[model samples]
Target chain A: MSEPEKALAARSLASCHDCALVVRLPAGRAHVAARCPRCGAKVHRRKVDSLARTWALVITAAMLYVPANIYPVMTVTSLGKSQSDTIMSGAIYLLQHGMWPLALVVFVASVLVPLLKLAALSGLLISVQRGSSWRPRDRTRLYRITEVVGPWSMVDIYVVTILMALVSLGQLASIEAGLGAVFFAGVVILTLLAAESFDPRLIWDRAEASHARS
Target chain B: MPEADGREHASPAVADAVIEERSRLSIVWVIPIVAVLVGTWLAYRAFTERGPLVTITFESAAGLEAGKTKVKYKDVEIGAVEQIDLSADLSGVVVQARLGREATRYLTENTRFWVVRAQVSAGRVSGLSTLFSGAYIGIDPSTEGRPQRHFQGLPVAPVVTSDVPGRLFTLRAKAGGSLEVGSPVYYRSADVGDVVASELDESGNHVTVKVFLRAPHDQRVRKNTRFWNVSGIDLRLSPEGLELDTVSLTSLLIGGAAFDTPKDQDPGGPVEEGAVFELYPNRRAMLQPKLTVKRPFLLHFEGSVGGLVDGAPVEFRGIQVGEVRNVRLEFDADTNKLRIPVLIELQPERIALNSGGAVVSIGMDEVRRNWDDLVARGMRAQLQSGNLLTGQLAIGLDFHPDAPPAKINWDAPIPELPTIPSPIEELKTGLSQFVKRLSEVPLEQVGNNLNKTLEQLERTLASANALIAPDSEAGSELRRLLRDLADAAQSIRLLADHLEQHPEDLIRGKGAE
Candidate 1:
């Protein structure tokens, strides 16, 4: 049976998110803060303000992304002359230098992956907010992909940091992190948290609501 | 809250998670808000980094391209070209450049812009390294000039910068020789500088060469410094023998300039920039000149000055104080006399009037006064062969102690100095006088006397021949004398034989040893 079809009859079971324990709640128990028998941790139907928190965090991440790609991530100084490159431009520089594979990896992690994660999170939020469940299973899979790939966008931040440390040669050559690197890192972390707060069962809730309406 | 909302949503509603019990806006919204602030800062920085725009016009845009070619000063890139187009006159290309913010402080009216290309000029080679990196515009901004945005480009790159230690000087020549732009300037056989530029003077009567004499070398230039054309081989066949003369072998082929400053206590300080100096035709000419020409005169002659050429010296007695400006043969129709008029330049400074080596200009009036006195003293100008083998004639001015008295004709059309016959003319006159005296003798009387003398001489010769005849009485007497001499010789030989045997006997008769 599909997940939504199975969730249709699940009003008596309470799953402990902390200890992974399954117990039966009293009949007609509603909105009760209960402790897991094994872990003694408070349990609820879903994460507190899961959709609202995810929405706020995703919007923040999307806003921060504007500056992340607009400004240069780091500056490279050689022979007393300095040149700064944005993430996209750095990727283009790599491509122009005949390192297409490295360029693609940077593009996917630094630019494309973040944008795709933001879009996927927004898609899931919109689908759940509309109480429309066209494909709950597919929607859940999209959220899973978004959560997994969200942290990879921080690759650019790590690259900048390592280059700054390893390439410091006093006046000969040095790499310094630019203001954009901070915002880009912030976007990555916020997006990861947004994906974390996003509730997959909200999608199934929509599916159940549609079934009930019919 | 979501569980309570969802449990309540079981009664009525669109069962999506909507927690209505709390404020709608979450604290997570500040992340996006902070990101917006950072974005605004980044946009401001991007806009502020750009500087003012400048436009430059060049003759050609051969290697320049928009956004690719950079404008550099001292190897530092300060701007980039943004646009290029043909100028309104279609005579050149105009380029617009956008400078970085830091470059704004250095833009000035005297900022010279030149495209750096690998160039080989007549005197210099530059920008070889630019061949790899490609051509770029180079700037030199002089601080003395005011600020400017628009500029006209340099046609040729200037080889020397103002910071380069050198002094510029102008050497004016009668004609432009083989001196090219990169020709060496030698001082005492050492190459010190190069000919940076050469052009005709405004009057176009002379060629003026611009030279950069580098420091230490430049200090060697004095106001009295003499420059000469160190070009061409000077091969002169003189009475001595064949001669080859040149300042240097390289100068003989490519041409060059050599300057020497006579050591003086003053040396007129160091030579000033743009100080004008005459370029002597050759090294010999430079050695002959002690001062510039201060006085000029025209002397007319009735005799031939065939070998006298331009630049020939006019010596007073044996000292050279002037030079021959020109020699021309002209006919005086009124007098029906062929007069050779010679123009000469006399530098009175060659003579130390005060014995202090002071170059005194005894004015033209003083010269005229001396001319009257010299005429009274029978001073005259003559053309003498300077080199007999080469037949080069130089003008000579000397005082003839016994010449006929002649007065200066002050009323003549041109200035007339009294003339005296040359030594050659005097010899010719003496010969002609002898011929006239010879012709003045009574030829008939002398012929009669000569005939009488010849008759007497013939009689004496006939008598001598008759006496010396083999059968004559004198011949017979000589033969008899010869026979007696042979008899006497025979007796003498017998006496000598007796003495040879009794030589000891004669010594003993004297002392019996």
Candidate 2:
């Protein structure tokens, strides 16, 4: 094998996730979990059960996404007239009110981004489980993008909370968050946890295992 | 041997991966389970909070807007309009609303719904806040009847709702006049209630006015309480004098009713809700003592009955004992004369007889015997002018001993009372006698004597003028005698002056000087 083909695992060395300490591993006791010598964090070749954990969180997020879109996220009462709007409907309302830029921003951050993150995580999970030798660099880049963009979906939730706090003028005007906001917040948090639980190194592991087989 | 030594040393540093068999369920799976449980709970709560849908039909959709109008009870919102549709027959608009689950128990058959708008009525202004907040559906719920999901809306809001602590009373009137819903009801001139409704019965005979009397004041209503419409000023010119009566200023504008027990009557036990009472036109009419046992008597009057009218007081010894009911001119063909028949209702209750042992109420049978005795004793009915200014007349019952004796005619439809000629009839006879005396005087002889007397006075004035002529001899003789008498008087005056001066000087009377 070439020098680049010599992998870190083949050398039996691991870096601690918490302290970043490099340590040589003990030999041939696969049933026992390893710990960092310096910081004593659990050590593994890849995140332990990364696919299964990510699958569980991503499934939860997907389930929550439905109610988030179906139910009203917030209700705005102005001059005694109350109106309730869901996420997609809110964005559409902004569009209808001659605010296309705001509509685009809301649509992308609140709706499109979370959905795309869920899809990308699920894809990464399946590909890793199938032991695919696909382009590992591009797949890792996708994971990086999903992890970075997943939190911005909270823009809708922030707007709802801020409006609820600020626009309380009693009988004249008020704002209240609805049940969908709770579910939406759950989805955003779940997706974030799912992305954190995912291990990009598993993609390279799949590639290496397939390459070793070839 | 050297490769084995190096491998063994490397194995000490290299850790083997552990294939730990753990529960397949991950901790992360708990999030989804919790989320699912929460979702199920939310769904269940939503399902439970959902109330039944109700439909209300209104005559006009004046203040209703689909999905915008809210249903309120005492200003607290309990529901919202969901949809509005035209009725199948196109008679009105049907509104569908969904209420909160808390309101389910109050949806009853007697529940009333009405639109509350800014209304300016004769009695007062209401719902002014609705002008700014827009109209809303008002509900008066009653849990007494069967559960209902449909209702017919009232065209106007009821003046008094069932929620108010009050008793509903019914008043029957010959005419409604100015009374209407929202009119005030007064107890002794104090406003204590409102007219909830005024409607004509199916037969259109009388008006049925439903009034609500608020608590405490409602308890004042008794079985014998009199209700009178004090809607306007009551001005009357009677023998008592010009009098004006009114309840209050509000009653003058919006119309109102007042109730009280007559002074002489007993205010019986408290009346239940919806007790019916007669509505008199005025307080005087209501205060007129009601005598249940009335005996009607007919009188044939020989004099003019022009000034008497129906309802004129029939007085015994100047005290009102009855009322005149009817008066008609009938041609008595058998007698070949015209007669005036007057029907009078006499209340025996007004006359109490002290029978030495106890005061006995006069019954009809007793009244018959009494009438026969009185008529034999020359008790007669006469028309007397009650008010000379108004020229109104009243039937006066008195003992006219000089009247021709007569007995009660029991054979007539109504017992006939003996009648005597009124004073005006006596004056007519006296006036006719004077006219006859004036006509019987000897006019020709009186005119001749007056002419002779006038001629004699003219002759005497002519002789007196002739005696006073200036050129006659008696005038010249009188002039000479006057001159001789003046001279003689002057001499006598001189002598008397001398004597007076001497005597006054001697008596120290200096007045002579």
- Interface quality of candidate 1 as DockQ: 0.15
Task: Please write out the lDDT profile of model 1 over residues B198-281, one tens digit for every residue.
Answer: 899899999998888888788888877888888778776542346776777777767889988655534566657878888887
TM-score top scorer: 2
Tens digit of per-residue lDDT, candidate 2, span B261-333: 9877889998889999999998889988777978899988876788788888899989999999999888989
Across A125-210, the per-residue lDDT of candidate 1 in tens digits comes to 99999998798999899889888777788888998999999999997789999978987998899889989999999898779778
TM-score of chain B of 2: 0.81
Quote each prediction's TM-score. Answer: 0.65, 0.79
Write down the C-alpha DockQ for each prediction: 0.15, 0.30
* Standalone chain B TM-score for every prediction: 0.67, 0.81
How much does each candidate deviate at the interface, measured as C-alpha RMSD after superposition? Answer: 9.3, 4.2
Candidate with the greatest lDDT versus the true structure? 2
| Docking class for candidate 1 | incorrect
Regions of candidate 1 where Cα sits further than 4 Å from its true position: A1-17, A22-121, A130-200, A210-214, B1-34, B121-123, B162-261, B269-295, B300-304, B335-338, B354-369, B416-513
